[model samples]
Target: MAKFSVSLKARLFLHDHGKLLLLKQTKPNGGNYSLIGGTIERKEFAIQTLIRESQEEAGIELSEDDLELVHVLHKRSAKEHRIVLYFRAYHYDGTPESKELEKFENVEWWSLKELPKNLTGTVRHVLKAYNAGLIYSHLRK
Candidate 1:
């Protein structure tokens, strides 16, 4: 049987200029850029997890009013299952920085039209979904 787990993720959209913020992880898994996100703690609501991760990973504080649920994607890896809750933030304070430098190298903003070509498959899928205006939750093989 496959091990199942719940992973919470949120993508930060900066303003209405069609730009997205991303972080480049360092060490262990360096040079890979991904959204600002992490796993959800047990018993934590998905929205709460989104807020927590934004603060932890990017130092951005998000409230319910500041975010809109985009989608929930079911992703499965070789060893674990993930329920990724994606969100779009229209309002926020503070700049994004690599608070966890030991694991995160840098944070930068990429225009939607100029996303890095080397994003992981999962990231690519999310971006495509967002661009296509299909934010509803879905299962991924």
Candidate 2:
């Protein structure tokens, strides 16, 4: 068997009032809207990564008790394999904003029924599957 590396990431779907929170990436980073989260560090768990990333990227504080695992994405590309855990949270502390100035330019909210066309492909896929009540999804490229 061939050995390959798989990256683990945790993302948040912070939804409220029929709207979801998104971070707008800088032009250098593709300028697309993305979920608020980050890669899971070597020593951290998925929930811990989400909590830390939410606070760092969006200034929102999350508790493990408030987060629910909604979807899991297994993505494979020619050069990389990644498994992303998507968590949905209704309750959090602080207002959402772009705290990572270099990576994100703005923070925006869009209705689930009317998502922005500029959303990243992965985000679009995950949202669609999530809304359809699917807990697991796979994407290959």
Candidate 3:
């Protein structure tokens, strides 16, 4: 048996009506739409990470009471193994904008039924699972 390193991420599914909040990254960063979130820090919990990430990446403020854990994904890519926690929040403070200009270019709302063609693969998979009332899913690449 061998030991492996796994990264943990916390993502937000901030939505209203039938729309979701998504970020468009600069070309150097991937040039695709993705959720607002980041890696969980060494001393932070998933919820705490989401709270901090929401503020830093999108200028949206989230409280512990505003978030609900909607899905968990175990993803194994060629580069790394990761466990991502997706939180759904219909309530938050401040209008969402791209605060990290180096990584993201635009902050936009998209209809769930008409998602952009450039949406990230991971986001698409997670959203499908979440919408299907799944709490956990696995993906390998």
Task: Write model 1 residue lDDT over 5-46, tens digit each, in one string.
Answer: 555554555444677788887758857788877766777776
Give the residue spans of candidate 1 off by over 4 A. 1-16, 77-79, 136-141
lDDT comparison, 1 vs 3, better candidate: 3
TM-score of each: 0.83, 0.96, 0.95
Output the lDDT of residue 124, model 1.
85
Task: Residues 1-115, candidate 3: write the lDDT tens digits.
Answer: 5567799999999998889999999999999999999999999999999999999999999999999999999999766789999999999999889999999998999999999
Over 4 Å off, model 2: none
lDDT of 2 at 123: 94
> Model 1 residue 6 lDDT?
53
The C-alpha local distance difference test score for the whole of candidate 1 amounts to 0.74
TM-score of 3: 0.95
Ranking by TM-score: 2, 3, 1
| Global Cα lDDT for candidate 2 | 0.93
Candidate 2: 10-residue stretch with minimal lDDT: 1-10
> Any runs in candidate 3 off by more than 4 Å, and if so which?
none
